[model samples]
Target: MQRKLAAIIAGDVVGYSRLMAEDEAQTYSELRAALREIVEPAVQRHGGRTFKYTGDGFLTAFGSVNAALEAAIDIQRGFGTCPLDLRLGLNLGDVIEEDGDIFGDGVNVANRLQAMAEPGTIYASASVVRSADKEHVARFRRIGRRQAKNIPEAIEVYAMHPDKAAPNGLARLLPARRLSWSRPRPTVLASICAGILVTGFIAAGSWTERAAAPPAAGSTSGSLRATAADSRPTVAVLPFDDLSAEPSQTYFADGLTEDVIANLARNRELMVIARNSTFALGDQPADIREIGERLGAQYVVEGSARRAGDQLRVVAQLIDARSGTHLWSHSYDQRIEDVFAVQADLTARIVSSLVSYVRQSEAAAAVARPTADLRAYDLVLRARGHHKHGGADRAALLEARDLYGRAVELDPRYATARAYLGLTYISEQFGWPTADAAELVARGLAEAREAIRLEPDLPLAYQVLSFGLAASGEYEGSMRAAQRAVELNGSDPDSLMALAKAQLRFGAYDEAVENAERARRLHPLAPEYYAYIHGQALYAAGRLEEADEVLAECTLRAPQDPDCLKIRAAVLVGLERPDEARAAMTELLRREPDFSLAGEEVGRRFGNSPLMRRFLSDLSRAEAPPSAA
Candidate 1:
């Protein structure tokens, strides 16, 4: 027998004997599949080898104790929805290796520990706990000293709880570093340092400092001039750094960043720069002032994410862009599923710090609960990212729709996912090829109605319902749903945008412009649709020059957007710019070869509205083709 120190891992399915007795063939097949698909891959990923398999259990060995613990955690998390419930145990000690098996006190202790672990949990011996990195150690929740059968000495044990507070040693280990990363104002500096230490990323030095303290004068005078001139307190949230030992968690970090951005965009009083612009900054060192100036943001939010076993820690800070001073900071240690709450908390704090006199209701809207099902929520977020990146990739939209479908399947009560699925269907219906638009709109309305029925209080459900209703020509219902959505979450950019569109279709020109402007303030980096609606609303109200200015910006921002081009053509015609009007119409026809005033859904929706009449007359004057006229 060869003896050496090793991390021994043992796992057993709960109620295995009973399950097999009840359905021998089915239970055996499910267990075998899980071991093959979930357990084996996790073991291999963490550098562990499964050396033995019991009828309903497995024994694995790893050179590093941390690897064994992590693999155990991964297995437990994966099995949360599996047919079998599993309890894992890990111990670090000298083990004897024989012909084809590992055996010793370590194996015995691991088995004993497994018997004590709760289902869906990993329990580790003191030696295993001590072997982990400090950051990993911070995730350990002590299970206390206990005596095990066949063991002479009492052993200390720990269980991984991702949602719990950090260990005491974490703060002691971190240095009292000053504002090298960036200065926080006096009021929040201490809290910021505390946040860094609590997140466990401080020891790894996962943050970067700018090369220069303040950006040079005139550095933002070029393209940034437009962004810089916006009067509202503009803000950007850079992508959070992923500090997880496993590379697979980078997506989780990205999702968290998106959630933060989404939350901030709910505040109608703040000008939140869109994720596309901030994410362009990437994970590199740059002057905050330069970032602020370039994005035309007055404030910046930056953060880092770390995951150890089942525990997750996120540290975030808000900084004043021009002064390089941090305004607020916090650390959240929670179960991975509670990430949405962390984002909500951080957004509310940042918004409060940047803007004064934020209404309690407005603040509440910024943190409205989306869903309680974490897995479903994750799928929805992933789908959102895919939808955003779908630009010309038809597959991306299909994949997003499938993901959203899966999310709702996992949790039938996940109203947010259902609502988003409604939106995805609408996008598929109207965008690109535009085939099956009518059929898709019918299906989308069903999804929207179902979402609203599932969670009547959810603002997003009503927002999507409004879009579906309007597309189906249920004008009265659409207007009512839009109004309800706005009343429920008046500060939400998406809610306001949806209401604005419904209002435009209803020919409530002044109200549409008001809502569109509110939406723009909430999302300064909004898509062309918001600007187009505002411009069209102005035109409907006979504010021709103002409409011209807005439509020009809309065309500049999204030259290819059919609606923007359509509005631009109308605005140019109203301004007596016949040449520009012709050019816009020509471009619009190129994108939509079948383009005609009579062929548009909007024209039908606003059939009796003056705006639609003027658009049709302008189409004739452009003289592109009889089809357009």
Candidate 2:
């Protein structure tokens, strides 16, 4: 019997049973060929040995974590063009080798991670990531803490996509450099690398510090920059040119651009630039490479929309920004009434080209039509335009609300319109001083529920419902709905932000910070509210400095936003900067004269939880105003 620490990899073929059932002989042959041609050579080249081969998968061991990861990545890349879909999981831990078989918690953990991984991807334990080479570390993105079946403690998981393009434009399947290897040593060095797994992973604070560090210079600010390490393809959609006979149809073109961006953003496999950032480029023509560099995007979507009377003609193209190649293009000519169908088709085709494997369910959800009534759809689009430009302007919000109301009346089955209408009411409660708060909350909740009833799968409806529930003091229900929204549309920034907000109110600060950070990454040009939510979560989690920095950005972005001011004051108080805290409170009071710690409104919103009590205590220390009553 022998015991030592080593890096272990567990792999399995996705849909192995179905493949074999369909063609047993062919499936067996392909599996054997993949093992012989791809897996064994990659393992041996990286100084690893394949210890065991299951009928449908294999287990490999390496003396070093780096070697194991390289082998796994190579194997996955090799299978990219093959019929088989492979998922790999890596772990660095102590294992027992007896009679040419390895056994222990280490092997169990690797198998669990393999099972959790998505098809054709790798999931590694935190210990594996921590021990990996810094260069290889860049290839990993933390998915979050996941509890594997029968695992005593949750394991923090990081994922890597093997098929993603390399930064140097070379294929990922390039042969790995051979490593000089002698006998595997069981020594202090191996123990040090395996220490984290023994200790049940690093503290949450440590993980956050690592993740929240500022991005390197020359990378895209506020975004998950697409580098050689992070291979998720980044895309930008510029505002479509309006070639309409009447210039008044420009809004239609802009609406099409926004819809395409929104749909593409829903696919987690691709990073879609926010509408604001891309649209800011306007209708200007420039070098595709330059636009890509500016947006940190590898692909660009450009199009033109022409509307003549009842006939609509739209032309769209997808360009490979790096090589200036037009990968795909399509022209659509349809009645004005079929514009929605055209938008759906355009979005689906773009997604098909960008993602290697597009889940039909997610693609369908992304292009789901809001309403069959053209008038209702047009009204909702106009309302969104007003909302986007309005910010906290009372007149603008009222105008949007009126338009959304008309849309709902025109097509009562329009879930998206009802959801947005509910959002406006909730916005009124926070930003409109003269608005009836209780009435708005009731109306918002009712509208949100109706939207959900109309379309249960609409992520936007669940997000709105979460806000309305939170406002109405249904904290648990609010959290549940927010979770459902994320589950339904994992890549939607709004859904993620809402979940973060709900998590914040429940004192799940770590999760709140994570989700909020994800939302910011997905939509780098996200509104000031994202900052507010993220900052508050950091503050609640006792990360005062990070909270202060994020809140400062929020204040700088929207100087007049009282929510930002309120959180900034709390963070400053925590940092022991009493004068700055008081200054923030003063500014907050200037903007919201009725702001008070002792008010029923504050109590209703924050409740009497320990976290909220601390928040109120901090506000009091900052000399915030007392209730008028």
Provide TM-scores for the models: 0.57, 0.66
Across residues 1-629, which tens digit of lDDT does each residue of candidate 1 receive? Answer: 89999999999987778767766777787788778766787888889999999999999999998788777766775564344667788999999999979999989999988877655567789898778888777666554455678988766766653332322332232223411122323423343343323322211111010011122232211111122122346678999999999997787888888777766665544556667556767655899987887666778999899977668899999899989998878899998767666776787788667655443334544465667777788788778778762255678888999999999989988887888888877766556536688888888888888888986656677878887777777766787798767544444657776777787778887777666665564454556676777787777777778888777777776787777787778778878999989999889898878787657635454535666676778766775465544
Q: Number of the top candidate by lDDT?
A: 2
What is the number of backbone collisions in each predicted candidate, taken in the order shown?
3, 0
Model 1 alpha-carbon drift over 4 Å, by segment: 1-236, 245-248, 264-286, 290-298, 344-372, 389-392, 432-436, 601-607
lDDT accuracy of residue 465 in candidate 2? 87
* Candidate no. 1 TM-score: 0.57
Across 43-79, the per-residue lDDT of candidate 2 in tens digits comes to: 9889998889888999999999999998888888776
Cα displacement (angstroms), candidate 1, residue 369, comes to 5.5
